[model samples]
Target: MNPVTAYRFITANQFAVVGASTDRSKYGNRVLRWYQAHELPVIPVNHKEATVESVPAIASIEEIDDPANAAISIITPPKVTLGVLKKAKELGIQKIWLQPGAEDKAVLDYAREAGLDIIAGGPCILVQGPSLLTHRANL
Candidate 1:
């Protein structure tokens, strides 16, 4: 993993928390809450909902008007995550963080093959979020 890429990913201001939910106990909800708590510009991507944690949830990455400038943190099932990865690549989203349980060999391979900056393999956003907030603040 490129240190620069990870740094860029962790420090990006605009983001989309794909698979976000309203249920506070879910990791999806926690991730969204972390972004909101930090006062960042974050879009909640959830096809089944109108909104998530007060932010209007978008159905897909293609729906985002400026996806290229934003990084994404995904917390969905493996199959859904694969589709999101494909769309993220298609939309030129440079960075992605896959929350624990969202990864698989195929997804990791695609991210590498697509040349995306990714955070995976068990370092969850909910754990790293405070550090990311500090990194963002210093930027």
Candidate 2:
């Protein structure tokens, strides 16, 4: 999807960052921290970790109370990401942003077939997020 549409889609929904990490240098941690820094509401989704970036991590997308209203930003490996996409589809999540290195042809194809509004092919949230602030404030 276009960056503008993707940005709007994310800001319009409840956001979540999957693949969160305790390590400060990882992309997962950076994504989580970015949302916090922007003062945006975002949950960290991590099965391995109990807490990430100081917030309790959700074990799965199934754990989100309102899956239909949420958008997930995936920063995991391609294998893990494919699995999360399947689960997210089952949970009624229609929007997803697969960060660089977390997406591959199979996953992209699956997401397309599922009719999800996806932001993939390298538009990182770390860059797009700040721009959304002005858009969000107008909402």
Candidate 3:
């Protein structure tokens, strides 16, 4: 639940938003916009869509060229979140940020077992991300 981890997670070579949606009312869209608004290198992960927020979307985590060098923010159902974690683990993507509804006992347990650098049961990135950026600006 460390905010520092969230900061480090996004400060990666690339950032992906899993379940990034076209629906503006959803948390998925909101989270994706957070990254975009901050002007970070971001890719949207949405299997059913060709693009999200005008950015080309990848179907899965494995589609990224360098999984080990990226961080992901997930906004899927708890069960689907577990599957995403499994894929991420198999691909060596360690930095994982599970948005509030994306985590459950099973998902957290697997993430723990997989030795993932995870942020769960903490503040959503939307809440802390701006402050973190402000801190970086001040630095």
Candidate 1 per-residue lDDT, tens place, 77-110, comes to 9888999999888888888888898989998998
> What lDDT does each candidate get?
0.84, 0.84, 0.89
lDDT of 3: 0.89
Q: Report the lDDT of model 2 for residue 8.
A: 55
Tens digits of per-residue lDDT, candidate 3, 1-139, equal 6766766775677899999999999999999999998888899999999999999999999899899889999999999999999999899987788999999999989988888879998888899677767644543
- Decide which is better by lDDT, 2 or 3: 3
- Candidate with maximal lDDT: 3
Alpha-carbon runs more than 4 Å astray in model 1? none
What total of clashing residue pairs does each candidate reach? Answer: 0, 0, 0
**TM-scores across all candidates?**
0.92, 0.92, 0.92
